[model samples]
Target: MYHESVMLNECLDGLNIRPDGVYVDVTFGGGGHSKAILARLGEKGKLLAFDQDPDAQQNAKLIDDKRFTFIEANFRYIKKYLRLYGIKQVDGILADFGISSHQIDEPTRGFSTRFDGDLDMRMNQKAEVSAFTVINKYPEDQLHKIFGMYGEIKNAKTLASAICSARMNAPIQTTGELKTILEKYAPKFKEFRYFAQVFQAIRIEVNQELEVIQEFLEQTPELLRDTESRLCIMTFHSLEDRLVKNYIKTGNFYGEPQKDIVYGTITKPLDAVSRKPIEASQEELARNNRSRSAKLRIATLSE
Candidate 1:
């Protein structure tokens, strides 16, 4: 499998799909969700999917359905692309965030800690900034911030100093070389988890994943047809889940609502369907280990 869709049925139920409604799958990695959406749609229903990764684009090509149209672009520019296709609004929007299984499994992509590959973790292969650039070119203070903020590593300052000192001897070129440096700073017996956190921080910076998610979420209100329209997002990590949760609650990333001084009304674009995010079932957890950390959040336009 290219990538197993986590919380598949839950996401579909959250979508509340209308048989003839127009929908979008912004992160069409393996097309598992997109294929399922198409199965539930009627003849008039249309499913437009977006992906910037060339590998994902290839996966999309195998689907030969008139109701499906694949857009080879980042989801951050979703509104602009939808307009080009004469689609001002959609009935539902689904986004499955984080790196895909295919990317991690492929050794050359450098997404997995177990694999010794080139330090290149760009979702879009054509992108200039890669993990190599982040590790080699970024300053020590910036590295400290990325490690502490994105990775949540405890020894981030010390790790940053070590990386700078080691790079002074030679440029950190490969994943293995970086891991060698990380091994020295990593906590005893928790080295693997530590390595993953550092790699995740670098990947997030290289792709600007958090920034893209906020931009994509900000556009959802205008794109949704009405209050009936749904927005279902599945995130792998806390950083992602927090953004989704906050935006749904307050229509902002900060989780702070703008109140109308006179009427004491909170001005927000979207409303949460549930107070808490939905987690994967025990059945799914047994089936796919990757689903363990997954969180599904649903929202609709505010009345």
Candidate 2:
């Protein structure tokens, strides 16, 4: 399978799709969600999907529905692209944020810790920065910050120092070479987790995933048609989930809300449909291990 859509039914239910309402799938990795959305839509309904990955573009090409349109750009520029398409607002927007299964399964992509590919983790292959550049060219302090902040890895400073020292011998060329260095610093029995964390950190930096997510989310309020419009996002890590949760609860990346001093009214663009994030069911967990860490949060425009 190119990618199995996690929480598929849950996501669809959260969307509460209208037969004739327009929708946007911001992360059209495998087109699984988009295909399902199309199935639920009427002839007049439209679905626009976005992906920067060339591989995904190919998958998108396989779909020949007149109601569907694929945008070959990053979702961060959602507003600009939508405006260009003459779409100012949509009924709902869905985002599944993280690396795709196809990217990880292909060793050349360098997204999986288990793979031995070139350290190239750019979501958009054309992007200048890659995991190779981050590991070999970044300064020790910058690496330290990336590992500590993005990966949430302890001893990040030590790991950064080790990377700087080792790369001086030669540029860290591949995932295997990087893993060899990481194995030394990884915890006694937690090497796999450590490697995943480090690779995730580097990947995040290379793709600027968090920044893109924020920019994308910031544009969603204006893009949504009204309070009935939904925004459903699935995040794989705390860093991503935090941003989504905070934005929904407070209308900013920060969890604190901005209040009007005169009337003491809190200003937030979106309201959470559920009090807490929704996780996969036991049945789904049994089928896909990747769904274990997945969290789904649904929101709507605040009144």
Candidate 3:
């Protein structure tokens, strides 16, 4: 199985679907959420889905609906691609971000820390950057920043120095090789957690994920038509979730909402529907282990 989408029912509910409206699934990983969205859409309704992974395209073939159009592209260009198809605005947009289960399960993709594979964690196969390049090629300072900022690893400095010192002998080309070099540093109790964070840091840098997310969020306000139009984003980590939360609340990626000088009122483009992110239900939590980290935040375009 590629992955079961987290909070499937809640995502559909938050969309505030209009049977005939236009919708876009920015992260059409396994097509689980896209199929659900298409079910609610009328014959006249259109659902444009985006996935940069070539593997996802095979999954897209399962849906033969004329209402569905699969775009083999990164969602950072959501507005550009939709415009080519004459979609200046959509009624709703749904994004389920983070690596899919298929990518993690397939050791060849190098996403999982469980099974050793090549040091490659690219979501897009064609992308030039890979985990191998980052580990062996990047300087200690850059690696330190990536681990600290992206992975939120507490001992990022030591980890970065370890990788650099080990790589002086030869390249760390595989997961097993890298893990072996860092063995001494891995905590006795939280070894898996440490490796996962290290791997996540490399993966994010390879994909430029946070930057793409920022670009994607910036486009959402202009993509939706009006107040009734909604944006549903499912984030798997705190960094991405924090960015989404801040953008929704402040209309910018940083700090509080900009204020109007005369009235001292904040100017924002979207009003968050739920003050807190929606978490998975007990039933969902029991089924998918991934939902524990999943956070669904929804907001609507303001008038």
Off by over 4 Å in 2: none
Could you give the C-alpha RMSD of every candidate to the true structure, in order shown? Answer: 0.8, 0.6, 1.0
| Model 2 poorest ten-residue lDDT run | 97-106
TM-score of each candidate? Answer: 0.99, 0.99, 0.98
**Per-residue alpha-carbon lDDT of model 1 for 157-176, expressed as tens digits?**
99999999999999988899
Query: How far in Å is the alpha carbon of 284 misplaced in model 2?
Result: 0.3
Worst 10 residues of 1 by lDDT: 98-107
Candidates by lDDT, descending order: 2, 1, 3
Give model 2's TM-score versus the native structure.
0.99
Give the Å shift of residue 25 in candidate 3: 0.2
The residue pairs that clash in candidate 3, if any, are: none
List clashing residue pairs in candidate 1.
none
Tell me the tens digit of each residue's lDDT in model 2 across 124-227.
98999999999989999999999999999999999999999999899999999999999999999999999999989998999999999999999999999998
